[model samples]
Target: MLPASTFVLGGAASGKSEWAEKFIESYDLPMIYLATGQIFDDEVAAKVAKHKNRRDGRWETIEEPLDLAPALASLSEKQAVLIDCATMWLTNHMMQDSDLSTEQDALIEALTACRAPWVIVSNEVGQGIVPENALARQFREAQGRLNIALAQQAGLVVQVVAGLPQSLKGRLP
Candidate 1:
């Protein structure tokens, strides 16, 4: 059985979202795709289109760059939601100079209180070489901390690599 909440982590271009989509599709629910990235450039737009094409008409798409907590809270418990990428959400917040701790608190709270079965995707950014720049280091640290917190609260935690999903905390659906 799928848990009330799941945390999916992977590196860039990994099959995290693909795995997530298939995982949730098994639940046989009309799922909501909460996209956090914006199409600000041609490259980004192309990527977004690819993802959209994958989900195509199967999901109710919600475009939210920031304020994930509020967007998540707005949905009914009956609506299954897959937050495609938390990295983007965090980046948006960071770009706006939002208080990270406070935003993370809100996110965790929302996830805990979410009545619907939900899944969130995030990048595992700390596994590679340390960044030389201070800002990059800070971002890496923040992402690591946030992922830890989310994993702790999640009913299931999975890390995908090379299109393979390795369950870290719970069984697959």
Candidate 2:
């Protein structure tokens, strides 16, 4: 397998996104930022804006809340793609009652087939207490399963904690 597929997983406020951003910056190729967030309120909008500002304006922005496979497929070998937080995308799919299995299959297929490097960021939501509601529990379980699947496919897997990155599977670039 090519060394282009990397997975970054961490808890909330764990600096995973920043780490991924810096890693992508090291590569001198054109970047595509695949944002999975939807601005539903001021707080979310502010958070999204902060991320946007962190990125160089030269990077192409693609706000895809779901259906990321097609976007990934459109990328070329010379471009690098940074998927900011797959957790939000999963949440969006869960909220819409979308089929998780189908989406995951499509994502894995795209990731495996893509020639360009992909830095996928996702929150590790299974480290905390058990959720109270059924929906929350389901989401947590789905996220865990998704992370596991992605990690298996990834050539490298890094878990960020307290702004420090711990390489779990492969060497850090």
Residue range 12-32, candidate 2, lDDT tens digits: 988999989888877778989
The C-alpha TM-scores of every prediction are 0.96, 0.96
In the range 85-107, model 1's lDDT, one tens digit per residue, is 88998888899999999999998
lDDT of 2: 0.90
**lDDT of the candidates, in the order given:** 0.89, 0.90
Q: How does residue 161 of candidate 1 score in lDDT?
A: 98
Residue pairs that clash (backbone atoms under 3 angstroms), model 2: none
Error of 1 at 29 (Å): 1.1
True lDDT of residue 168, candidate 2:
95
For each candidate, how many residue pairs have backbone atoms clashing (under 3 Å)?
0, 0
- Quote the positional error of residue 65 for candidate 2 in Å: 0.6
